[model samples]
Each structure stands twice: as C-alpha cells, then as structure tokens.
Target chain A: MTVKQLTLPELTEACVRLGVPGVGLWREPVRAYGTEAAAKLVHDAGLAVTTLCRGGFLTAIDPAARADALDDNRAAIDEAVTLGTDTLVLVSGGLPPGSRDLHGARERIADALAVLAPYAGERGVRLAIEPLHPMYASDRCVVSTLDQALDLAERFPVEQVGVVVDTYHLWWDDRAPAAIVRAGDRIHSFQLADWTTPLPAGVLNGRGLIGDGVIDLRAWRERVDAAGYQGPIEVELFNDTLWVRDGVELLTDVAERYVRHAL
Target chain B: MTVKQLTLPELTEACVRLGVPGVGLWREPVRAYGTEAAAKLVHDAGLAVTTLCRGGFLTAIDPAARADALDDNRAAIDEAVTLGTDTLVLVSGGLPPGSRDLHGARERIADALAVLAPYAGERGVRLAIEPLHPMYASDRCVVSTLDQALDLAERFPVEQVGVVVDTYHLWWDDRAPAAIVRAGDRIHSFQLADWTTPLPAGVLNGRGLIGDGVIDLRAWRERVDAAGYQGPIEVELFNDTLWVRDGVELLTDVAERYVRHAL
Candidate 1:
C-alpha cells in the first residue's frame, strides 16, 4: 500500500499484509469506494470491521437541521450494519453556530440520542458515544469525559447505547480508570492512539501513532479487559507524519508496536 | 498606564491611578520592582492586595528542582504575607519534563501541598489552587476542572486551602454550578473575564475583557453568590488588547461593566 494515496482495495490489502486484525473506517473513505465495495474489499480480505468512525453531529441552530442529524445517524447505523460492524461511534457535536450555550448543546445531544437509539437497536448496531477531549468543546464535541459518556449511556438501554474509550482523548483524565470500571459492559469500544508533542496546524494532526507518544496503553488494556470488554481494540492514528508514510510501513510499525506496547 | 517602556514604579502607579482596587501581580513584575519595595508601595497607598498571580510550579524532572519548587513556593507564600494578600493563587504545573506520568506528577503536587499548607496557614495566607482549562493540561496545570480543585481542597483545612474559580477556565464545565456549590466556603476567589472568538496565538492572547466576549457574567455571579460566597468577585483580564489600552480607561470600563453586568 502506498502512503501518498490509499484506496479501499489498497487499505484492505495493507491491513491483511500488516496483520492488523481490525480497522476503524472513516465515512469519507467508505464513501469514496462506495460502502458496498469497501465492505466487500474488507470482508474478502478477512479483515474485521471494528467500528465506523462517526455518526453524530447533532448540534444545529435550526430544529430542522437537528432532525436531519437523527435521520443521517440512522443512515450511519445502516452503514455500520452493512459493514458488519456492531459499534457505530458518535461524536456528540458542539454548540450551535455563534452560540456559547454548552448546556443547550448537551440537551440537543440527549434528544438526538433518544431518536437515534431506537433505530440503531432495530438494526442490531450499538451506538457508542465517543467522549472527545475538552479541547474540542468549542467547535467539535460537547461530551468531553468518560463519566459524561457513561451518564449518556445510562439514559439508553444497555444493548442499544454504549461508550468508546479512546486513549488519545482520555489519557490525561484522572477519572478514566474508574469511569471504565463504571462503564463495564457498556464500554463497547477501546480505541488507542498517543498524544503528540507539537499540535499541528489543524490540531487533528497532533494525534500520535500508538507507541510513538506517552500513553499507558498496557494499563488501559488491563483496565478495559477487567471491565469485561473483550472487543477488538482499534488503533486509530491521525498523524500527518504516519499518513504520509507507505501504508505497509505504517501498518507494520503499528502492528509490531501494538503487540509490544499496547496488546 | 502608558503602554510603552514603563518601569515597575510606573506600572504600580498606573494600577493605583486606574482605581482597580488591586492587581493580580505576577512574579516578573514583583521581581522587577523588588518584592519588598512593591509591598511598601501598596502599603503606602493603602491599596488592598487581592491575590498573588502564582506560586506552584512543583513539577520538575530533577528531584532537587522539585524541592527547589517547594522552597520557591515557600518564598512566594512569604511574599504574599508581606504584601498582605490573603490568597496565594497556585497554578499547579504540568507533567514533569520527559515524563508522561500524570498521576505521578499529581501525587507530587499533593505531597508539596501537604508540606506547604501548614506554613501558609501560619503566615495568615490561604493557598488558592486555580484549575486552568484542560487545553493547558500538558504544559501549564494538571488541575483542569472545578470538581478536580474541590477534590484537592477536600484534603486540606478550609482555612489553609481553597479554590480560585475563574470563569475563563470553567465556563465550559457542565457541572460548574454544582461544583461551585460543593466548594461553598472553600471558594477563596471568584474571577471574571469573557471568552472571545478566534482564540489568539492559541494561548495567552485569547482572554477577553469583560463584556467583550460570550460569558454570561450575571448568571455566573448569581450562581457564585447563591453558593454563599460573599467575597468581592475580582475582574482579572489577561487580554493583550486591554494591556495596550490606558490602565485608567481599562479599569473604568471594567468597573462599570462589572457593576452593570456582574453585580
């Protein structure tokens, strides 16, 4: 697989060649290859679809747009179902445009979840609310802690809604271990990545490849395992450096490091 | 105050002339004026010393440097006592150099506080641990929420330790009001400022002058007041724009807005 550009076919081949058991697929990449074609490529390669990267962007200044988000999330659930991925990650969106009302945004998230959970349950997909880092509070996700994600999980049936515990977003959280224990079976996904030193131009580029930066991934694995979640732990790195490398090289490094440092 | 080429004496005189009641004096300015001379000037003017801007930088890679931090904090406490400021604001430093052990650094902070608390109490000064925003978690302060500050405060005597609830750091917290209520008498100081759009330089230049940004100051004042804190809510703006303006003009505008929108 080449680093300069990655097609669904190349990504699937890379995953198989690098021996990564599973991969977290972003929506744009899936859309690029067409969902059916992407699903067939991964399935043909015998690669597990750990999760679909996102579903929720519920914050909207207009009620119509808010309703539209729920409809869109239902479509995402269908996509997850088609991909044979049970977990659909949701990033509860930030405050409405020009609005500083964080509380109101939270309420909107709750409302969106209430609408989306039923459809996800019917589709046999578990909706995982991923608590982003607090840095994203202004323009990304309002859910910024595992405790907050657990709180949201409590509002829905256990089989329908859960939480994605990402090390990159939560490694600094003092309450992470306790929150993981509290999540128990509701912890649907355990995602890993490292926090880089210098934040890139977009802040998103600052995510480090697993084992590249400082994160207690072994401890996290023990915690999640102890909490009764035996699901595939996805390594989702968004590093510009890694992204520019040959896909085979990147995947091989990640797989080796994941086994040595994370698994 | 004149924006250009001002000596410490000139800066101090400008603060007094601006009718700001008290300034949140930093160590650099204190060092520039000589701590004793600065104290004498405040004493001579009969101006109240509201709070010292900082004390804690307890995280260091070298054990000797960490000990040095404790010693320096002791000196800061003595300076606060000499200045007649009841509250010494502590900005808990971030992860020690070359270490990703956040939990270990937190333990060191607790240990330092335990050693410093009794000495601070003896000097008739309270240590106010200010929890900065989470964005500064890596390089600035580990304490990043009001709830975390309250958790730390629970370890010390109410008279010796408390929290500085700054709106700039906490406006995004969903549990801020409840945490404020929980802090109650442990709330040593209430600081005001506004959150502006386009955070400048992504750090120091981002703070907005009161009423110029999006914080609901009146609601915050009501909540803090309801929590039974009768202390004067101080206006602490760290804006580059405000720093460039005439100190008299800045203070007048702040005072008028504080009364009109906050009180």
Candidate 2:
C-alpha cells in the first residue's frame, strides 16, 4: 500500500507518468472503486495488473468460518482474473482465536489451498503464498518463513501455487537466499518493503521506503532474478509516515527509491 | 524480566517462599547488588541461580567496538561464575549501524562466541545463544530462530555453547519443534513469554506474561522435555504493563501462570 492515498485512476495516472509499468492492486480499494472499472483504467493506461493484494485467512477452526474463507478466496481468484493478474497473494491466517495449535492452523491453510489452488489454476490465476515476518505470526499469518511457504506450496503444482519473496518479511532469514533458489520458477511475485527499526504501534504500518532500512535490496533482486522469477518487482509498503504525504509525491519517491536501491 | 521489580534478595526470598527452586539473574541488577553479595544471598537462601540474563552485542563493524564487546562478554562470563550459574544467555546483537550484511553480522557473533565460549566453559559456564524474535533482529539480535542459534552454537563444544529456546521468540517458527529435537543437549536454557496482539510502541516491552497470550507453553515444555532438556523453565517477561504492579504479587502471578500454562 505504498501510495494508498491515491485513487485507482490517480494511481494508474501516476504509474504511467512515472513509467512504473505494472500496478499491484489491493482488494479493498479495487472493490470500492469497482473492480471492472479499475481493470479497464489500468488496461487503458497500458499498465499490467501485477497482482491482487490478498486472499487466504483460512486458519479457522469453525467450519462456517472455513467455508466463508474458501468463498472469499474463490471471490479473490475471480477478482484476479478480472484484473488480468495471474498472481493472487495469499496471507495464510494466524492461529484461530485462543488456539495454540500452530500445526493444526498451518494444516488448515494447506487444506484450504487444496480446495482453492485448482480453482485458481483452472482460471489461470496462481495462489502466491506470502510468508509474513514471524512478528506477524500471531494475528496476521502463521506462514512466517520462505521455507515454510515453500513447504506448503511445493505440495501443489508449480502452475497452481507459488511464493512471494518480500524483502521486509524475509531479509532476517539467512536461509532465505537458499530457499529462493529452491523456489525457482515458483516465485510468482517479488515484493519490496524495507525493514525499519522501532516498528510502529500495532506493528502494521512501519514498512520503510526501500533505501531507508538495512536490507540489501539490490542483492535480493539479484537472488530473485537468479531464481528464474521473471515477474514484476512490486513495491508494496504499509508505512504510516509516507501515507500522510501527497500520494503522487510518495509514488515519485517510491519510483526513485526502487531505481536507486532495488535496480 | 518477569519479576524485575523484586530486588535480588527479595526475588530469592519469593522463590524460597513459593518453593521455586531456581532464579535467573540479569547482569545489571546483580552488578548493582554486588555480584558476590547477590551470589551469597541466593546461595544462603537455598536457591539456584539458573542463569545470567545476557552477554552479547558482538555485531560491531569497528574493531575497537568488537574488542569492547569481547571484553564485556568476558566480564559477563566472570559474573556468571561468581553467581555460580553455569549458563550465560547471549542476545547476539543486530546489524552494525548501517550495515546490510546479516551474514556478516552473524559471523561477527560467531567470532565473539569463539572467544567467549571457551572462556565461559573453562569457568564452568556455557554461553547460551538466546535467539530473540525476528522483530528484534534489527536492533536486538540477528539470531532470530532456534535453528539459527543451533547453527551458531553447534560450531562450539556443547559444554561451551548451546541454544536458549525462549517460547516468546521461537513459538512462531513452524520448524522450531523439530529444531528443538535436533538441539538435544545443546539446548542450554528454556524461557517463557506469550504472544499478545497489537504490540506496544517500541515493541521491546510488549512480551506477554505466561497464559496471557497465544503460545502453547506446556507443549513447548513437553517438546523441550522430549528433547532431553532438564534445565529450569524460566518465565521471562518484558511487559511494561506488569512492571507497574507489586513485585511480590507479580511473582505470585507468574508462579501461578507458570504452573497453569507452562508446567
């Protein structure tokens, strides 16, 4: 959500002006702006819809909740199709409320993927499992490492499921480079969000502007390139500090940061 | 630092009164109380000094800084010996100032351990590598997983170096259970702190007291038990909310929670 302050049309317009070829759209804003209209806007502007933000909070113990999640995921897959983005990022949900069974919770994610992966595959949309940082393992997503994401995704066909290599989430992991190699063509989407210290309260919106943090963004880009991931390198930041600024200005900054640090 | 409000003597007294056999000591407070005096107080009170809180921060890029870290670690080992504790927990430091090389930082920790481990071992103490949570990997410790800690500790003799499986830091890792098994006798210390949501600002003092959040403490205890760890199960919380309460009352609450959730 780097330029979350911009409207869909404004985002597409900025991308075109900034020469940012592809735009990754979050589901909420897309739905709010009319998905078909958003698809048309980006399409008409000659920009690729790189990915649909999310769809997987499937770690529910309640059967009804599980059904709801599956339905939501199916809807997300449909949205991806409409947006013409083959990649649907799945943030596998955290442990169900008051449940200490992380294993069971992960298994539930696998179960949901079993139902959704093929549905996604049939529609030419791949489920991209984005393993968030372990700090987010409680309420955000239990998938906390590249290896864990690979373990889950490897069970499905390469065409059906894959992983997102986000620098912010996986930079602390020493083995992530090796895991990236293993991910190979299964690296569906590569995202960039640098890690900044003293994470903001709620720990949700502290993502750094690329070069502002310690991550070797270029090094990660090289590794992902070596892994045969010929995908769009999307800058997906959730930063409060940047959000308050003008959206177009932030987008310009992001484009400059990406070229300077991530290129 | 669950019962940090309690003085050394007060902590020892509470342990005795509550039939708690052992207490872990942090370096600063013990140094403040006089290391020898603190040792005598705990020993005279019939309590075991389970461990010394820490001795790390070896990821300095400057040679003089690295040398200082080593000298400080040497003193920590000395303090652990004086306290009659065989374990000195190490919170291996994070990135050196502007450095983006996590591998280099981790190598620095290894370099520090090479010097300190044997020194501690000679004095009947083991350097326990406590992998802080990945959230702390930026400023606190680069060793963010038990597997990473084991990777470092295994380079030294088990008597000289080992890993600390702190629930708060490790419970999020899907592979931690298997890593615990792999650790076997290299597991030096076991600590408890639960995972709570909407982490507080700064993110350093939000660790939950046992049973207050999402960790399966009893299961972790059982896993470590199965892995042949016979050490004291230390309840270490760095919660700001709990620190304001009465020390004795907090100790009682911790003891109750430990028995209920961690036993």
Candidate 3:
C-alpha cells in the first residue's frame, strides 16, 4: 500500500504514463472503486493485475466467524478471477482473541486452506500464504517464517497454494534464503517492503521506503530469480510516512527506488 | 528486570522475606552497588545469585569499538565470577552502523565468542546467549532465534557456552520448542516474560509482566524442564507501567505471577 493515496483510476493513469507494467490491488480500494471497473481501468490502460491483496484471516475460533471468513475468502477468489490475476496473497490471521495456542491457530489456518485451496484451484487462483514478520505474530499471522509457510503450503497442491516472499518480513531470518530456494516454483508472489528501526507505535505501518532501510533488496531479487520465480515483484509497503505524500510523486519515487534498489 | 524498581539491598531483603530463592543481577545496578558488595548483600541475605544480565555487543565494525566490547565482556565475565553466578547472559549486539550484513554480524558474534567463551569458562562461568526478539534484529541483537543461538553455542563446550530460553523472545517461534529439546543441557537460564500487544514506540521496554500477556509461560518452563534445564527461572519484565509501581508491591505481584503463571 505504498501509494494508497491514489484512487484506482488515478493509479492506473499514473502507471500507464510512468511505464509501470502492473499493479497489485488491495481489496478495500478495489471494492470501493467497484472491482470490475477497477479491473477494466487497469486492463484498458494496458497494465497487468499482478496479484489481489488478500484472502485469508482464517484463524477465527467461533463457527460463525469461521464460516464468514470462508465466505469472504470465496468472494476474494472470485474477485481475483475477475481481476484476471491468478494469485491472491493471504496474510493469514493471528491467534484468536485470548488464545495462546499457536499450534492450534496454525492448524486452523491449514484447515481453512484445505477447503479454500481447492476452490481457488478450480478458479485458477493460487492462495499465496504471506508469512508476516515475527513482530506481528501475536496479532497478525501465526506463520512467522518462510519455512513455516512452506510447511503449510506443501501440504496442499503446489498449483493451489504457494508462498509470498516479502523481504521486510523474512530478511531477519538466516534460514529464509535457503527457504526461498526451497520454495522454488511455489513462490507465487514476491513482494518488497524494507524494514526500518524504532518502529512506530503498533509496529504495523513502519515499513521503510525501498532504499531507506538496511535490506539487500537487489540480493533478494537475485535470490528469488535464482529460485525460478518468474512472477511480478510487487513493492507492497505499509508506511504512514509515504502515504501522506502526493500519490503520483510517491508512485514515481517508488518506481525509481524499485529500479535503483531492487532491480 | 521485573523488580528493577528495587535497589540491590532492597531486592535481596524482599527476596528473603518473600521466600524467593535467588536473583539475577544486571551489570549496571551491580556496578553501581559494587559487585562484591552486591554479592555479599545477596549472600548475606541467604539468597542465591542466579545469573548476570549481559556481556555481548560484539558486532562493532570499528577496531576500537570491537576492542571496547571485548574488554567490557571480559569485565562482565569477571563480574559474574565475583557475584558467584556461573551464568553470564549475552545479548549479542545487532548490525553495526549503516550495515546490512546480518550474516556478517552473526559471524562477528561467533568470532567474539571464540575469544571470550574460554575466558569465561576459565573463570568458572558459562556464557548464555540470549536471542532477543526479531523486532530488535536491526539494532539490538542479530541472534533472533533459539536455533541460531544454539548454532553459535554448539561451537564451544556446553559447560562454556549455552542458550537462554526467554518466553517473550521465543514464544512466537514454532520451531523453538524443538530447538529447546535439541538444546538439552545447553539451556543455561530460563527467563519468563509475556507477549503483549500494540508494542510501545521503541519496542524495547514493552515486555509484559509474567502472567499479563499471551505467552504460555508455564508451558515454556515445562519444555525447558523436559530439556533437562534445572536452573533459575527469572522473571525479566521491562514494562514502563510496572517500573512506576511500588517496588515491593511489584516484586510481590511478580512473585505471585511467577507462581500462578509460570510455575
């Protein structure tokens, strides 16, 4: 959500003018702009829809909540299909309210994927399990390592379920490089969000601009390329600092940073 | 540092009155109180000296800074010996200034240990590598996982080098339980701190009181016990809220929480 300030039409127009080839769309903004119109705008502008933002928060303990999550995921899969993107990135939800059963929560994610993966496969959408940084493990996602995500994804068909390798989340992990290699062709979506220090309160929106942090972005790019990932390398940042800037300027800056740092 | 509010003397007196068996001492306070004097105070009060707070920041790039870290660690080893504690917990420092080499930083820690482990062992003290949480990977400690700590610790004799199992730092990792089992007798010190949400600004001092947050402290204690760790289970909390409370009351609460939540 690096340039979240941009409306879908404005984003698509800017992308076309800037020679950007694809745009990954988050559900909220796409839903707000009407997903069909949003998809058409990007398609008419000759830009690919890289990946849908999300599809999973499947750790709800209540039966009703679980059913609602499943329905929401099914809708997400349909939206991905409508957007003509085969990948739906899943920030699998964290532990239920007061529960400390990490294993149980993770198992629940697997159960949700068991039902949703086949449905997504039928619709030509692969659920990309995004293992968020461990700082977010308590309230965001139980899957904190690429190894763990691969463990969960390997249980399902590689065509149905895969992993999203985000540098911000996985850079601290020494095992992640090897895990990325092991992920190989199952790497559905590759994302870049730099990690910066003295994280702002809540630690959710402190993602750095591409070149502002300490990550070896180009190294990550080369690693994923070597791992047989031929997917779009999306810059998916959640930064409060960048969001306040002009959307077109931020998008241009992001494009420049991607080429200079990530490419 | 659950009862950091208590002075060294007050801490020993309170521990004695509360039937607490031992206490872990931080170098700063012990230095302020005079290491020998602090040791005598705890011993005279019939309390065991559990473990020393820290000794490692060995990732400095500059020659002068690296030398200072080694000297300081040597002092810490000496202090641990004087305090009659066999364990000196090491929080290996993070990446050096402006550096993105996490692997290199970790290797520097190994290099430092290669120099200091034997020094501490010669003085009848074992260096306990405490892996700080991954959130601190950028600026605090590069050792972000128990397995990583074990990887470093296993390079030396078990009597000379070992790992600390802290609930707050390791509870997010699914692989930690297995790593603890793998650690076996190399588990030097077992610490208890809970995982709470909406982490504070810097994310350093937000460690929850023993029973206040999401971690299953007793389960960790039991796991370490199963791994053959028969050592002090120190409650180390860095909460700003707890620090402002009455020291005696906080100490009493921590003791009660230890029994109720971590025993």
> Whose DockQ is greatest here?
2
Top-lDDT structure, candidate number? 3
What is the per-residue lDDT of model 2 for residues B183-262, given as tens digits with 9 covering 90 to 100?
Answer: 99999999989999889988998999889899988999999999999889888889889999999999998999888987
Reference-based lDDT, residue A20, model 1: 73
User: How well is each residue in A1-263 modelled by candidate 2, as lDDT tens digits?
Assistant: 78889888899999999999999999999999999999999999999999998999999999999999999999999999999999999999988888988888889999999999999999999999999998899898999999999999999999999999999999999889999999999999999999998888999999999999999999999999998888899998998899999999999999998999989
lDDT of 1 by residue, B1-263 (tens): 21223455665576577665665666667767788888888777756778887899876768799789999999999989877788999999987656778777777788888999999999999999998887677778888889888888779999899999899898877788999999999999999878765555446556777777667888888999988988767887776777777755566677778888787
Q: Kindly provide the TM-score of model 1 when superposed on the true structure, using C-alpha atoms.
A: 0.91
- Candidate 3 i-RMS: 0.7
lDDT of the structure predicted as candidate 1 = 0.81
Off by over 4 Å in 2: none
Which pairs of residues collide in model 2? none
Deviation of model 3 at B17, angstroms: 1.2
In candidate 3, which residue pairs get closer than 3 Å at backbone N, Cα or C atoms, i.e. clash? none
Worst 10 residues of 1 chain B by lDDT: B1-10
Error of 1 at A184 (Å): 1.5
Candidate 3 lDDT by residue in tens digits, A10-92: 89899998899999999999998898998888898999999998988999999999999999999999999999999999999
- My TM-score estimates for the predictions, one after another, are 0.91, 0.98, 0.98
Ranked candidates, highest DockQ first: 2, 3, 1
Give me the chain B TM-score of candidate 2: 0.98
Residues A62-105, candidate 1: write the lDDT tens digits: 97897788788888999999899999999988777667687778
Query: Fraction of the real A/B interface contacts present in each candidate?
Result: 0.20, 0.90, 0.85
